[model samples]
Target: MQPTPLATSPMPDSEMLRLRQEFVDASWWLTLVYALISSALLPARAWLLGSWRLSDSIIFLFIAGYLLAFGQRRRLGGWWRDSPPVLVMMLGGSTGLLGNGLLGSGLMTLIFANTLVAVLFGRRVVWIAFLYTMGVVLLAAWLYASGRLPPRVSSDYSSSPLAWLMAISSGTLMSFLVLHFVSLYRQRVEALHERLRVQSEEIARLAHHDELTGLPSLRLARDRLRMACHQAERQRSKAALLFIDLDGFKRINDSAGHEAGDEVLRVVAARMVEAVRSVDTVARLGGDEFIVILSGVPDARTATEVAQKIVAAAAAPIPWQGCTLQIGASIGIALYPEHSDTPEDLLRRADSAMYSVKRGGKNGYALHEEPRTPGHTCQPC
Candidate 1:
């Protein structure tokens, strides 16, 4: 049977929650924006064009301070908490520089560099920084062409159009390069994860299956018996358990080490598999012991035919230990309800019948269809 379904991934990982992390990482910047906005409008500075203003810078700083504090205290400590605040903080600050000030474009460039180094190139921050850089250039162009923004010295800056163009071209190129490498890294990581998942599933399957016989091992056979019994009870149908012991197997094992014995078992198992219907189960209980579970069997006839086929298959030459040694199986059949209802009970009854055959005579099968009553000679019904 195939394996059970895998559990879904818990919370699709840190990379999936893209926007959330950005905001948390940049929490400090909101306060700074407010300060800058407030101070820009304030009529306090008396330098350059007019009075220098401190209101916009102060307001931006205070708001940034509040956001940073909230993120660090309430969100940063927990593993599943929201982002670090700085990533988003820097993102927004860069967007503002797109149109904030013609002279501040260089400042935004420096911020982009810092964000790239902090979040690492393979993360979502790479794209965010690139777009912000493009915005900064776009805003600078608009302001420069519209004549709304003046340079450090208005009269002197107006003549340097070539310098401005060069800056825009170089910065846009740098941002594109960062985006290219980040995309490549993301693909590589995803491929590695998929490979690991497949290998894990393969290892788990190998652990439960017998390689040579293509049957369940001791651990898996026990589990399957329990599951089958539960299904039989639900359907109101009977289940039959058969324990098969190959006579003269020790002679084969001794003559041919384990490799030849294994080959004999594999060949025998293949024939037994064909003898039973696909709906039934054949499992390697261990060494020379095997189990066959017949589900929804209506009566003894169904069990008898399957046991007879197994007898014939074992009687055929199976190349035992490579010398073509003949092998025979002594089968013990025990029915559900007729013998025992539980998986353990059925196994015990089948095992007893098999031993009875081994001691009575080899190359034959037996079944315990009726319970022992008061006192009388019991015969096959």
Candidate 2:
């Protein structure tokens, strides 16, 4: 049998939300990383090619200001939702222009840009980014070929040491992003599986246990009763089934309202559980009706003593709304192999005995006995 679970807190809509948020925060650091490396390489590229512009310093300031303002923001919504894609595009476009177009080491930056965009946005936006980047590279190539743009001091910049450095740095950034995202994705999947497992167990618990008092429902009680009878038959020991009906419960509901009645039932259920032995089973069959199964009882006398305890426990006044609410228990007992060996027959006999107690008087226990006449009838409670 599965153990009872404590109350569970509400689950988030999707476990992936946490991973996405982490990805957002990480994207900022990634952009800052690219900014630092690319900014450091700017002076080397200018000295190697002997072409530097005022726009280079302006772009560096823009990258720094952008990172300082929004790099640490963890939220994924509002104005900054599209910031990652824009940042990647800026880095990719500028690198491709400064390096000798896509024919040189700038190709790696374009690839890294598309990769980041794909992860942050979806496939469709990545396509748009790719086209936009290709357009920028093509326009720069056309201007340089048409003699509109000035030629660099060194035409062999692609064969220089600076190209190798840029390639290694960009490759490192891409590898780190892929590995980190994969690790985070695995954690999100594990968390989702754990939530599903807990939900399945809670669903099974609700099926077999009463929601109100957290006691075993009729289904679980019946299964336990069958097990008890089978064990008693094998060992030649005895087991008792006590059918309990709460008396004066209707009067309490009628007078104090259902909330008070519910409180009273909770208190009574707790008391009955305390009154029984640890090996015994207490179940709530339905509204105001309960059952107790006792295994390894010596005889009817011992079963009667347990039933007496249940009666006294149920009879205790439950305080509700600054007033005492009185209720009582009417229990009927049927022993295994004495009344009947089968669980169904034992329960029927016990229920019959309980109705008999209701007919005679309320708030008492009775044992199953042979009816004196065939015309006996019971009224609806």
Candidate 3:
């Protein structure tokens, strides 16, 4: 059977949708984590500072936002679907801006957010996120320079246990994000490589096998013939080449149609394989023609016996479409070191012998007889 071509297009819509849903679910988990972290920080800050600063209200707002986003995550659609990367990046950037500005965890948070976007979305979305981040940093820098915003003293929180806790928590989450996506990317690459390796093997198989009968093609047959001859030479034994032609195949093709003829050929090929020894090579030489290489044969007589089995196999009726299709095999065998030691000579002489059988009425086997003079002749077996 002919192999179906491998797909080279993007994933199907169902798969794409499923992947998007997974990302959506992951986003919800991220939101829930952020809310929990913020909630924990609120209590830690109240205990450390002895009183809640007014800026603590901003933390409350952020915590509420995270919780609300997490709750409504399943309902994310329309605008949420189209621009989740933008929404997520902005949320992360906002947290960094209000918590410590870009000088603190804000810068790191923004970078991680961009990386997250890069993983889920394409490069285009990542580029847009980068531009947005740069714009925010520049605006914040300008405001601080112009005295429009109060100067954030890094030393104010740098030595605080609360600041350290926040840093450790955020860093751990960001690192997990980086590692998770990195592992996913690696798995996808490995899967792709495996698919390519399998496809390469399939392409090689199709190249050297018959599409119709799934038997070895002429190229593979020739390679086997050469190896058989070489092995026979080393072992000081005999090898034989059998050339087979299906009798009345043209008549079947013309009368019943090519489909029926193909079925017949497939059946014949299977029968021929069953008739030969497991070590022997049975190959198709295209359209109603096949070749068998019998390795390490004792004599021409052994080759003849194998050919006789093949003839009996082919002579059996093949059932197709509620009708019995009758066919026969005309076999010609030539031995190595006796007829000719070379694969080329053995194939040529066997083919000549097969034609001799066809000319002398088909459905029989012949042994190649080398011409003593100019003309060639085949000795019927």
Candidate 4:
């Protein structure tokens, strides 16, 4: 049979929502920067030439639209987030056709815009942006060669092959740097997520277990008992609750300090675990007090035998600090359906019986006996 798989906890909804908002904010700022830069440069270039070209007017219109979209960003969706780079590419292509085909600065902007698309989006978007840019460049080149597009007017650098080479090389270098940093940022985020996942698992484990003895804590033990009761009721089988208290734990703590007391507790916990079956649960209720849940118990005899084993195991001398230290356990056993049906009631009865053993004398075991009255509950002895 295949082993049962552990349940995986999902990322919290609040965390995912926060990340989405952060991305939206990042995209908003990026668009804002691009708009501010374009609004400043386009008007200046038109003024310098003493006339506004159709390409410059179109770019201004695109910038206005982008600003409007940003103003209502919360109302807009993914389209608003992706529109800036797409608009830049279109503006670059138009400017290239109006100026000097592949020789103009518009080609440089197109390259940069494509690089931004790759940085912000996925591989598919990168490919789409790349193909669009290439198509625009080729189409402008064709229009110029065929005498359909206007010749170079704003600048004479278009005639120089060295100028074209420098523009392409610089654009390529800038895009490479942008893409490299984006990759590094993604890797860092992934590493942080992995660390958080591991820490979450550890926090969950620590919450359910005792730090000192490495046993299930009282709350976890109570939950286990409740589950055991449900299972017994369903299967029509007996379950046992063993409440154990260390006889001289307080004296040990007082005489040997808390460190030695902790050591003794760890040793006793290990011994109690060894004395129980694989199906049984051994838990530390608190400070030297432990509980065991025995499932599928055949009869009271089995519980009694297990209680005797635990008492012996716990009473054995522990070797510590080059000397032998001794402690005793008083165990109380309560059977499901015989003493009480509920997990709470069973545990209470077992606790009462354990006190009876302590009162009678240390280092012994007791089975809880039901009260004579129909409604009266057994009190602690």
Candidate 5:
């Protein structure tokens, strides 16, 4: 599923840290490469160009900055949210400033475009553009006043030196004002986006995971199982659904506070995940109950093996709150079609068998079979 804007925002905290470390390690190597090439190349170009202007060097720096930022883009996100938008504004500003020195015409136009990009992008893309626009307009205007503007040629009376300078100078001043206004608008938009991003992340985390166990909740589990079942069916094979219930969960919760009970659940959830096949699915259906879906199981034997593995894993006493605590689970095994056809039906059969095991004797698994009732929970006819 396509993630919301916030979900796709900057890299996750863990990934961000890893990339930061990698960037630090790799940065020096890239610098050394650039240094080696520039030591040999930049001097030659500067000598041949006969003393390059600051703007000329600025262009090269802008390109290098873009490359550095772009290298991290894939890790961050490619669309809508990567890179500081302000930096882009600054980049455009630099381009226009450099253009003024090299191309010498339409410097005002370049600065204006920088403002446009800045105003358009907001926080993730703000101030950099604004700074460049301001720099070009004020500096260029000052330079023009000092006779830095190119002299106008008069073939027609319409072309006058005073008029040409005034018009270009006025245009630069006007664009700077426009850029200033754009900056304010962008700031407001950035604030709104930040608010939305926070809310989006909060909602996504709550929806996909259990509050107590920190495992995928039933809604998310259903989606995963649906996909796994589809794959198993395509291969004309089978999958196992194990309904897991902690044997004495209620007594532990009632005796030791809910906090201690929660820890047990967390411990059990972790073990369940560790016990299963890598292709299996583990989900919490709330309050001391869990489910495991094992894919590509060939028959009841395979399903039985998985259920036994989980029971073994759960039987290991979990270390919690600096004390070892005992836990046992009753599991129900239900194979696809052998138990029932649909996801819900399979889950119900597995659940029934789990209850049977829980009642007959705790800490064991019962293979699901048709209940002795017509249309009972839609068990196989």
Candidate 6:
């Protein structure tokens, strides 16, 4: 089987929309976690330091600001949703300035910020965020080296070393947990997209093909017929429509089971395919009725030869169930611009000619001749 276009193309619109919603929901939940963690760490920082430090104050304000921004996200649009990376970067800088320099809380914050950026905006944005974070770390190192930034603790008050360790460790653990789950969600989304792509291809195949004989269905045949007519009109050539009906299909179907009937039909379908060229179209139009589109037919003789080949192929015996089954086909030929210009009219004329052959005798083919009057019947040759 050929590879479907859906299999090769990019992710469809529905999948993109679903992924966007998933990212938005993940960001919201992550922000909520950030708010809760900050709330828990606020009192601990004040207790350990014996007073509220600039970093502690910033964390408190961030908790409130993040909540407010999330609440107004719909009004603020994408900017509100994208503000977390910048907010976290600010928090990291403040903590680094208040705590140790680049080695302590600052380094941990940068790592967590990079993870958040990856989860929120994917790989392309993470690199930009990473460079910005490195710049901040270098700036912090220079300030500390120049003696402009204060030491880890103020000279007047001493803080517990364990407090700094607990803050950094807890934040790192939370960020890691969020990153792990985000990765899992992305994998799940990819799997779902693959399943949807397979289903879409199957649906497209079924819509254009017949289930029994593996031939083009009636709908696809009509489309091809219309396209062939347009091409013939452009090239100033003639196209022929051949309508075929099995002579004793109903009798075989009624005598034997549907399984046998299906086998016979498949055999007939195969024969019809062998009779046509690569560019010609052969389609099953339900039951025992089939249509063949012969493009660039120079004259009626070429069309008759193709119809005769189909008739002869159908007359061949098919071996089945320790017995030989026999059948015949009656075909009607209609030429474009001679019999009818439109696909519908051509089909009707061909069908009428096939009935004319059936009225004369089975196992024969006929060409549609123009009617003399509006009420006059079609004559077949």
lDDT of 6: 0.75
Give candidate 5 misplaced runs (Cα > 4 Å): 1-177, 187-198, 370-381
Clashes of 5: 9
lDDT value, residue 127 of candidate 6:
82
Q: Count of backbone clashes for each model? A: 38, 0, 0, 0, 9, 0
Model 5 residue 365 lDDT?
74
- Candidate 3 contains a number of clashing pairs equal to 0
Instruction: Give one digit per residue, the lDDT tens place, for model 3 in 1-381.
Output: 233455463334544455555654665566457557867876676676566656567656666765665567567775464354335446656555654565556677777777667656777877988898888788777776787875444456778777777778777777775676566556655666676687778778878998788899999999999999998999999999999999989889889988889898899999989988899989999889999999999898898888888888998998889999998888888999799878998999999888878876788788886311112444443
lDDT of all predictions: 0.63, 0.76, 0.75, 0.73, 0.63, 0.75
> What is every candidate's alpha-carbon RMSD to the true fold?
12.8, 6.7, 5.9, 11.6, 15.2, 10.6
Candidate 6 lDDT tens digits, 132-217: 77777777778888898866554433355554555555566557556766676677678777877788877787789887788898
Best by lDDT: 2
Judge candidate 2 against the unseen true structure and give its global Cα lDDT, from 0 to 1.
Answer: 0.76
- Report the lDDT of model 4 for residue 348: 94
The pairs that clash in candidate 5 are 85-124, 85-125, 85-126, 86-125, 86-126, 86-128, 89-129, 90-128, 90-129
TM-score of each: 0.57, 0.71, 0.71, 0.60, 0.51, 0.57
Q: Which candidate model has the greater TM-score, 2 or 6?
A: 2
Better of 2 and 3 by lDDT: 2
Clashing pairs in 3: none
Of 5 and 6, the candidate ahead on TM-score is: 6
